[model samples]
Target: MKILILKRDKLGDMLLTTPMFALLRQHFPGARIDVLANTYNAWVIDGNTDVSRVWSYQRVKEGGRIHWRAAFAQLRQTLALRAEEYDWIIVANGDASHRAIKRAAWLGGCNLVSYTDAKNSHRKVNHPLEIPRQIHEARRMANLLTPLGISLPEVLPPLRFQLPAEAQTFANQWLAEQGLTPGSYITLGLGARRAKKQPTTEQIIRWTRHFHEAWGLKTVFMWTPGKSDNPMYPGDDETAQPVLDAKLPWLVPFRGPLKPALGLIFNGRTSLFPDSGLMHFAAASPGGVLGFFAETDVSPAPAQWGPVGPRARWLEAPKAVSQLEDASVFAELESLLK
Candidate 1:
């Protein structure tokens, strides 16, 4: 059997579907399970064992004009996929109106499974499942497999992100240079998609001191690597500067590519982050993860997108994350650490 799973989305969204890949492998051990991921999030599944192959494509940014060369390349890839004659094509994204489902239908798969909402009631999905109003994204992805007799477990497995051997080596060397060892420190990610979701510099300093005094663990601060002015992918250079300027010996600053950064997070005792891609990466690690999310009525609740794992925990503030009291934040941290 051959299957195609479409999850060409953001980093967090791609990570959420990892459990479904594992379940598919277990159910059909010999089946070839491939994934259609985008260039941005394909790294999440680089070393994943369950996926037979990963096909990646670039996504044009919203409102950006599509280049002819890129369009032709996409068309070629789509035609190739249609030729594969997959037994099943599952649109693993939670959104009912995701364009990937329409592409799946065009692929002429023998069986197509996807979500159906009021807006997408007419989409051609052979096995249509209504989008669940209240469920973790991982569970929502798992629901797509029900048509194949794969049932959701009471407890979904944690997100999966395997570090490559090279990255592990780099992490080990970097830690040695800094006189640190695995599980001996904590990581604090300083980047969030929106500035409002991040904790203030003073708050970060307080947290660092608290962690050091309470538990002898040093803190490693990681942030996005480019200037905020970059049009393509704005980063947190300005946001991280104040914390870095403090020059606290115990507060190590890290700015690099995603893989090595992930390696460092995986080796830490635990990690703290705002609601961002790094938070999702940390959730996949063996160490505990704590995420601070902003609550907004217009967006999906933190309960849906927040980290999911035995060791993952999150706190939500009604307005901006700055509104969360230090006492409440520390209390949640105490519970998570214990």
Candidate 2:
């Protein structure tokens, strides 16, 4: 048997679909399971044993016009995928749209499985499942497997993110240089794609001090590595500068590639983040994860996108995350640690 999962989305969204990969491997041990991810998120499953292979293409931004070359490349890749003649092609996203369904149909699978909504019907999907409303993203994705006789478990499994050996080595070396050990510190991620979701610099400093004074754990500060002015990949260099310049002994700054950063986060006691991709990465790791969400009309609510795991917890602010009181955030962290 052969299966192809289309999860060509953001980093956090890609991580959410990992449970589906594990379930597929468990149910069909002999099946060749593969994934079609995008360049941005392919690393999430780089060394995952459940996936036989991974095929990736550059993802064009939504509503942005695609260059002719990029469009041709995508067409060529899609044609190649169609040639594979997969037994099943599952659109792994929860709210698969009409365009997403049509794209999966082009993949030429014997069975095309996806979710159906008002905009998209079952006519295109050989096996269609109704989209589950206001559920964890992982469980919502697992619903698609019902057609193959795989039932959703009462509790979903933890998310997966495999760290490469070299990345692990890099993290270990860096930790040694800083006189730190695994689980002795917290990873503090200071980047959020949205302005309203980010905590203020004062809030960040306060949180770092609270971790040290309350939990006696140092903080390893990290941020998206780039200039904020870059339109393609806006980062938190400017936002992180003041905190980094503070010269706080308990705070160590980290700046590097995503893989090694994952290594550091995996080794930490826990990771604190605003609603961002790094938060999802920490949730997938073995360490504890705490995230803050600012509910907005354009974004999915915490009910759907919140972290999932015994050690994972998220606090949603009624308005912007900046408005969340330091005492409330600290209280939630204490609960998470307990």
Candidate 3:
């Protein structure tokens, strides 16, 4: 069987699709599975045992109606995908954008399955799975496999991110050069798609100080430099500067690329984040993570996108990070450490 998975999204969205890949392999052991993912998120699907190959989809807006250039570009890409003659094409994640429906149809497969919350999108696909509200995102993707007779676990497995051997070597050398011990340091991911989700620099400083004083764990800050040109959570580096400028005794700065940063996360005692890509990264890691998420009536809550793992914990605020208290954050960290 030849199967194609269309999961072209950002880090968390891409990572959440890993369970579906595993389930597909379990149901159809001999099937050749290919994944269509964004250039940024291609790494998440890469090196997976279940996926035969990963096709890069560079243009996030390719299927959208707004830009003719992107639509034309998608047409060209679709021609190549259609040639593969996949027996089944599954659109694992769906936005309100009509582009997802357009892209799925354009790929031209024998059986096309998709999940969407929109009523209009339900009419366009062969199998349109209506996603349930307030469930973890991974479970929503896993629901796509029900048509194939795959029964998923009550608690889906954590997102999978495989770092290369070089990343591990780089992390070890970087930590050694910084005079830090492995498993005795905490990593603070200081990037957020929205300013409201980000905890103040003062909050980070105070928490780091507490962890340092109480647990003797030195803190390191990591961030991705957000670029305006990128549509998907370009990330912000500015959040890290305040912590650095404060020259806090226990704080260290180790900002760089994603894979190597993930290597450091793998070895760290624990990490903290504010609904950023790093939260997903740390959730994929073996290390513990405390994620702070803010949701209003319009936004999805922690119950929907919270981290999943034995050691992963999430604290939800009403509308912004400012609504969450510092002591509550510390208490969560203390509990995670225990």
Q: Total clashes, candidate 2?
A: 0
Q: Pick the candidate with the highest TM-score.
A: 1
Rank list by TM-score: 1, 2, 3
The segments of candidate 3 whose C-alpha lies over 4 angstroms from its true place after superposition are: 60-77, 94-96, 116-124, 226-237
Instruction: For each candidate, give its TM-score against the true structure.
Output: 0.90, 0.88, 0.87
- lDDT for every model? 0.84, 0.84, 0.78
- lDDT tens digits, residue span 1-338, model 3: 89998876778788778877888887898999998876767887668898899887556344343666656766778899999998888887734436666677878888888766545473547776776666777887888887767788886655666877888999889999989877888888766767778788878878889889889999878887665346644656566666789998898888688888888988888889877667877877777789988865666577777777778888888888878888888888787777
C-alpha-based local distance difference test score of model 1: 0.84
Error of model 1, residue 177, in angstroms: 2.7
Give lDDT: candidate 1, residue 154.
92
Q: Which regions of candidate 1 fall more than 4 Å away from where they truly are?
A: 60-69, 121-123, 229-231, 334-338
Report how far residue 323 has shifted in candidate 2, in Å. Answer: 2.9
**Model 3 clash number:** 0
Q: What is the lDDT of candidate 3?
A: 0.78
